[model samples]
Target: MKLLSPKLLLLPMLCWVQQAAAQQTTEALSDVQKIEYASPGVRGMGKPRGIVVEYERLPQFDIDSKSDDPEIGNGSARVRRHNKFSVRALAPIMNKPQTKLILGIDHSFEEFNFENVTPATYSLYNSLEDKNLKSVGLQLAFLHSPNEVNFYLVRAKAELNGDYTRDNINISDYLKTTIDVAYGWKRSPDFAWGIGFQLGYTFGRQRVYPGILYNRTFNDKWGVESIFPANARLRLNVSEKTLLYTGYRIEGASYNLLASNPPLSKFNDIELRRTDFKGLVRLEQEIYDFLWFAVEGGFRQYYRHRVFDDVGSRDYIIKNDLAGAGYIGVEIFAVPPRRFTEGRKNK
Candidate 1:
């Protein structure tokens, strides 16, 4: 009986060791897959989204613009609606154990509807309401890992953003370029972190900023994913098929408008600068294998929404501080198949 007692005590310890080994194996597999398939939005935080369609809308808000020059009009207007829709696709062109290359393309359309202009003197309002702003972007990214723990990523994206009008049709005038570079340490399957720098125009003007990436899985039910100054979210795993996130995101862009629009013709190329800050709650649910649906809603605030002729001269035409409003967004996205995420593990 004494000998049997020792054996019984060891049984639980052996089972615990086996469970730990299994969890480590699963986490290591996730890391291996991330090396091959880095996500487009937040690098290796979560599953790579292959195809995505999204829409966002804002409610009514009051906005008034002031200009130094009276010809451009100092006026107040009520914005009835603001809507945006976007589509994105990502594909891995080259995949290897130590290196990966991905290609992505995205397109967006934005519309603004205005009513009740106090002084119907601004001609630009007609152009703004009638013409939808559009953006087409092309991105290429490369990831390399010299060994199992350390990796670096480089990405470049080019965007053509503007209202499609005969006067604003010049491609060169509408092009905007951005670049991102980072160095990461995949310390374990459950955690990763990195630091980098970004050259982009998320503030409605071209600026350089530091970037930080942190991805941590605390347990099966809770985690965090963040890329600072862009987005940060607290993740909740409600179930295998459902996830919830609460976080904030920064969104902004520069768009080219009609050079022929009135008083601005004396200036150089016309550009509209816009930025939004939002604190949101997002819910993602799997409808079936590989297909998912996401819905998010939040309050939107304007950081800066203005018009400028040439940033070099620093002459601003119209400056606006619109009232805050609630906004909602929905998405339909697809993830990789079992063959890409599962079968590779056995091999």
Candidate 2:
């Protein structure tokens, strides 16, 4: 008797084993009550139950600055760095069926430094100055997940930032608020996908220089959000703490001078717009019962365009093509169960 081919013989066994293992894992997880405090800021099914905090550092590089303009000098040869830190807490508001209210605060600081070349020719008076920015924000979210089919999340957030500073001059100050809602479709225990929409509005002021005062204003009123400064994010979960996130954001602003009438024309009004396509991959490892460490890297492409009416006749539009930025950061997570736990533990 001839023996059956090895490929045919092994295929059915592999399928059977896989199916059995999946079923077993599912049953085991079902017995385990869904943890309410998994991720501190965001709520989801099978998330960790506790408060968590994290800190991160990200560095960005612009690759296209090399060939764009010869007269415009290249500032930095190395990567530009941006630092970020965040803290979050989650609590079980009502549990019997497992419901959670998540509260979080995140603070981020960013500084963009440019390389100095041709110090004599491109002096501080002529070269573009470096910038430092700081932002602080709060987030509140409600999460509900009843089985795989019924899952929903809602979040509201507010952010405020001080004026961006360059060469000791204040550039802008901004405030923004955002709201989001999402629904999920979970095909299995290991895989889930979601779609969400975010709407936001920003109010800000821009400063004008002394020489440009006749042409520009000291402060310009501006508002932007989803339509002009908006974003959509797509999220995928690889495990309980690890996630893969990618998204697109568009931001724009227009400015007008105060002294001019029909501000749009006399002010040499201008609107600047940028679109960013970004992706991030993160891994979370628990350091202790309440502490975790996360490492993440992000890749981004930036597109910028500016439209302004020239001092003379016609309008001028300029576009900066795609530029690349890459960043890597590590975060430390700390969560204490109760407010008094810190004092009690020391004793």
Candidate 3:
């Protein structure tokens, strides 16, 4: 089954099962409703996920660092350790057959620890040691089915990413926002397509781009899900309890960082823009009634890593070219009870 559209892809669980089970007493859904949120009796979307959490500690990787200023002189850079943590939850604000409103929240934190054997070099590298980045986001997803065959998907998200502590946090300096709206058609229970415009920082900066969301289920064992230009995955249903996926994903972000010590003492703050493109494989297995665990491994290619003045007083100050590195992550999430979904299917 397909996940959320590209705009709302940050939270990829499709749990409308309880809603589907409750809808058994209601009339048939229009074409859009069936495709956007599949009926339980149909073999379309999968899972009734509620909460998801992920953690990863990427290994030490070599990095080649350069700067717009040659006088700062540097030798090499290495990321000694990188730790990432994230969590997300989704709940229905309003659920109906014709219209659905879902609210989701996501929080993420990351730490980059640089290996510094000798401190006699570049100022930028000195300041980059032990840097931290954080983000908290809110998203509202709206699925509207006006008629039988047509549907619309609208999603908006606002995030704050930065290095500021609780004492000095400023909303105006760290807020980043995005919006995605697409028009889709339900050709059948197992196929759907849509096109939409996305305005956000998917490439480490602000830009507007068009995307095509295509989902197809070939059989009980095979499926494909994608939002073009951002993500795509091939799905394999090995059994009722296990699932596998191999796909591509792009991650991008801009963080406002504090300027405390040397090197950046002149500026109030600096901005870090980064993007990563990866191809990966994932395996998901049920752990208990509603608990599931997943393991993912991938090779990440750095697309952009740049630094600039936050006040827009100057052009980019630094650019680093990072080599591709292999990465791995693990996750645990909650899905609806099997009894509830099975019950809906037998209806």
Candidate 4:
């Protein structure tokens, strides 16, 4: 039990989208009508403008036996599921309207299973049953506005994580890098805000964080979208082809394992950090004009499932439970023609 708590229904939808953006503005507002009333296009609820393919499943995800590893002679550790598949692409390669450039590619696949173990967890699923996790990512985006209410964003990303079955693939030892910048303000026609700083280099140190983003639109059926520590949502517009959301997200990954065997063969390389915290409910429809269909359900809170010993730094823990999951997705996108950003409408 104990579920419901999407920040308590997102604080009354963020106080009604900040009092409906301060009662529908008062002068000075343009920047393309304040970025179209601070987001409600690209199919509302943000994130739309190119490619994406998603798949997720968490069948069971249970494995709680609390072990400080005394050869796990009992207690628990069965884990029979947990899978994911993803593919994403975002491309715009510069399409001016006050500066814009984008290019992105991401790939992911995570699998975990035990098939029903027990021999004291069989040495932790026989060292993850021939490990070979995957991750590939790359992104570059820059968008500038300078007018229409100010906007600026810059991003750079790269990630190549993990266990390619037994080592022997060193793209600089499985890289991970990120850089981001932000500065946006629409502050009128329905609010908007941004601030940023994100520079990272995972698992081997180097980090710098600080971020905030916002979007609001209280009319057309409620709204609020955020990206702080990374994720937030509360949008409900069951019309214009449906939509509904209630969110929370925080997912992590950092893999690169295969230190030979037996408790990580004295260590030289082995790192598997996984984190999760989700509580969601999503729904989106729209079945034409570029297609869309989504359905989600969740509650899989298990922050961290560790394993580290990059040459004896020492760390181990494998089961952090609490699970539930379901999702279905399909999206084919490309938007921006409501008479070219909402104009000519008379017939």
Cα lDDT for residue 115, model 4? 57
Any residue pairs clashing in model 4, and if so which?
31-148
Candidate 3 local distance difference test against the native: 0.67
Error of 1 at 250 (Å): 1.0
Report the lDDT tens digits of candidate 1 across residue range 160-211. 7887655547778778777777777766766766777767766777777676
Relative to the true structure, candidate 1 reaches a TM of 0.85
Model 4 Cα displacement at 66 (Å)? 22
The alpha-carbon deviation from the true structure for residue 171 of candidate 4, after best TM-score superposition, in angstroms, is 29
Every candidate's CA RMSD: 13.0, 18.1, 4.9, 16.0
Is 1 or 3 the stronger prediction by TM-score?
3
Model 3, TM vs. native: 0.86
Q: Which ranking of candidates, highest TM-score first?
A: 3, 1, 2, 4
- CA displacement after TM-score superposition, residue 44 of candidate 4 (Å): 17
Q: Per model, state how many residue pairs clash.
A: 0, 6, 1, 1
2 or 4, greater by TM-score = 2
* TM-score per candidate, chains pooled: 0.85, 0.48, 0.86, 0.32
- Find the number of clashing residue pairs for candidate 1: 0
Writing each residue's lDDT as its tens digit, candidate 4 over 1-347 gives 11111111112122222322232222233665533323111124432445556666666555654446654433345566655666666655765545656677767666666655555435545666535477777767666555657666767777777765333777777776667666767766556777766664222233565657777768888877765665677888878667798987655556666655455455567666655567788887766654566777766666555565561245554444444454333344443333432332121
Off by over 4 Å in 1: 1-45, 165-168, 311-313
Error of 4 at 12 (Å): 20
